[model samples]
Target chain A: MSPRQKRQLSLEVNGEPYELLVEPHWLLVDVLRDQLHLTGTKIGCGIGVCGACTVLVDGQAVSSCLALAVDAHGKAVTTIEGLAREGRLHPIQQAFIACGGFQCGFCTPGMIMGAKELLDRNPAPTEEEIRAGLSGNLCRCTGYVKIIESVQVAVRLLQEEMAGEAGAPVSPGPGRHAAVGSGQGGAR
Target chain B: MALWPFDYLEPTSPEECFALMAEHGSEAKLLAGGTALMQFLKQGLARPRALINLKRLPGLGGIEVGPEGALRLGALATHRRIEDAPLVRERWPMLAEMLQLVASPRIRNMATIGGNLCHGDANEDPPPLLLALDASVRVISRVGERLLPVDGLFTDFYETALKPGELLAEVRVPPLPPRSGAVYLKFAPKSRQDFATVGAAAFVRLADAGRCVELRLGLAGVAPTPVRARKVEAALQGQLLSEPLVREAAALVEDEIDPVGDIRGSAGYKREMAKLFLRRAVAEALRRAGAAGPGPT
Candidate 1:
């Protein structure tokens, strides 16, 4: 039996209001995946060594595994599931799918979430910033080449969208043959 | 991983935090950003009875520019806030560079500058640079407030001057003198998350004719705590800015520091690396002062 008190936790995750009875000690990652069934927020190395549990808390990326659920009260949380809208994927999400950003996919949610944060803060981050932005996250399967390509594509897509390039269809390129939902290793 | 069970208090005012500290003193841990503190709890290194959340406190997160171009950085200022500040980038580019190299974006977002300074981990990079800048810390408690020189903040290995009931309030950094430049350089093997094996920060002020007027040298991962190479500082105080002077000052650093061997690197390797970093950092700082200010690139 877990000796923890239940608290009324009110949070806005993915632009939706959620009021759940959460244990005071429960991590935000647990609340998102276990209670809310938002499995897109995966947990890896619960001690914060791995950035697989990254999520946007109030538009800033934080390691949800280390963040207590109670601390997220009155805050906004965004997970991988929140990246798409109206049957259309967010440009970054689409770019990741197109650009072979993930190989094993265990680290995809975190990679995308971390990328989302960088683009939000600095729309046109340099190559060094992208390397530094995703430094906390470790992807053993795909060398960072395709991941870097994915971010570059997203930058162009998001930039076009910002400049009123609405409904621009993502074209095929080096990212065209990326496997979707297969979770296999990308090109060596 | 769930946090260990503990009572929580979110105090919006300093008085409430003080009162809680007085009541729970050693039993409670004040949490700011919860980056390092939460990691401690999760690892079972600490099991405080209560957690006093400092996030709700007002007036603890602002960065104010004082008269004489001093910077008064609040304890709760996040690394992101400090790294991107126009004043910090313009006046203290070393701080900006160090912040950019610290951890990563996700960690930097939730980690506080005060928390990083307070942690005092040898492998960490900020404390040494701050000490080189001659910064002072403002600590508050139920009793009153006290200002401690950054050099005096760290006592022994992994220990600081902070008492049980007191909290670090702010860090006051005086403006750098003209003709002076500072640089922080660290060597981390493998990826960026790895702790540094050797780190050096140098602040050098040159004379009108390009001679060294003043010098402050700080080294990390080369001592139990981040420390100033006082012997090296004394050697280069009045010397001309040259390769020979830099080599002399760098040679003195190896004698002043006593680093212990660990998985990061051998003690001898650390010493040699320290010398290399010191020489490079001093040369770069002097060159910056000689040029027409450090231009943006």
Candidate 2:
């Protein structure tokens, strides 16, 4: 009769690699929050229904609460804690602040992470697309209007950031209006 | 949702998986995506001694379509992959649309089609549509491999026909026939992500003069297992369908489903909904086939 044993998990989280021993039953959230002490990834519903524990695994959003930590071995994971660069807040975080997108701050990190994934995929998504993209992540504050407005502002900010990055007129995606009106109302 | 301590086993090959399955027997559960099984673990509904993860199993995560338009979805192909596949969107639009209606995007990214089926939840969205599309699953074990029609896969609540030491390898979906149209409708009024109050799927093929050449109806959330309404299909086969006639055939579902409703609705409400949705799904399928007018004759 064999006893349950811990397994070694090696994963790159937010550009940092770590090697740790994790229990077989332990979830990715457990490894991230408890082991690594990265408490930004919240566990809301425990089940996958709430978007509280959402994280990016290999660039695709998935529920950390439902994923096994060992299964994340050899993969790249991005939590809400990983978004900043050079001690400056990511544009999504800035947009959330600029637009007052959050209330009580419990769902903010997850919302920002979800938005980062969404904007990374489609730089300029429609309001409906933004709503559907973040469907899994719920805001209990019922601040959906400002949350959507925050995403819209992020679209413009990201477009401006990309336009600045590219140093010329750039087409973000298939969305025409988000691109053609580049100069007007970008920061707001 | 504190999971019990268990040994984690990652098998790189099917033979190794089968061997482990044989050794662990029912005490071990095969891990595919772990979206549902994790719930089973956290809720203490399943106290497995080990979890044999299928993530490392090679050649099982592919999504390939044959030249004949048949889709061979490897067991590990995530719902996100299937939903975003270009060929699937072009050929099997009904399936693509249905995948979008599944839980949220995060769940879809983590949930695999094989895992969803093997989870054997009667209220899930995929089984009804897969049943209507005439999908079959390739189940493998140490002895050999065999294909089981999707209908024969589910045995009961959270149970499947897969024997011990066997695992689902792939899901094979045959191409839709010419002049055929398919649809899946989930009646979840509360939230788009909620399990269906009742789910219905229909595949219809038309011959000349709009006569029904073939019809298949599948329903979920109203039975012990996802069920095909063969009696209804039999009644509509080779007949020129009218709204009244289709409604008459759909009414047969009232007796076919055995729903034990909880918060969704009463069992009687679900049975009634099953009949109504069966009729609507068939009508929509017919219209999509261009076999009938916008309003059914």
Least accurate stretch of 10 residues (summed lDDT) in model 1 chain A?
A: A179-188
Q: All models, DockQ values?
A: 0.64, 0.71
Q: Candidate 1's residue-wise lDDT over B139-160, tens digit each?
A: 9988899999989989887789
lDDT of 1 by residue, A52-155 (tens): 99999999999998788899999999999998887778878877877778888999999999999999888998888898888998888888888987887788
| Residue ranges of candidate 1 with Cα displaced over 4 Å | A1-4, A164-188, B291-297
Error of 2 at A136 (Å): 1.3
Stretches of candidate 2 off by over 4 Å are: A1-3, A168-188, B67-69, B294-297
RMSD of 2: 3.6
Fraction of true inter-chain Cα contacts (below 8 Å) kept per model? 0.76, 0.78
As a whole number from 0 to 100, the lDDT of residue B69 in candidate 2 is 70
Q: CA shift at B69, candidate 1, in angstroms?
A: 2.5
Q: How far out, in Å, is residue A163 in model 1?
A: 3.9
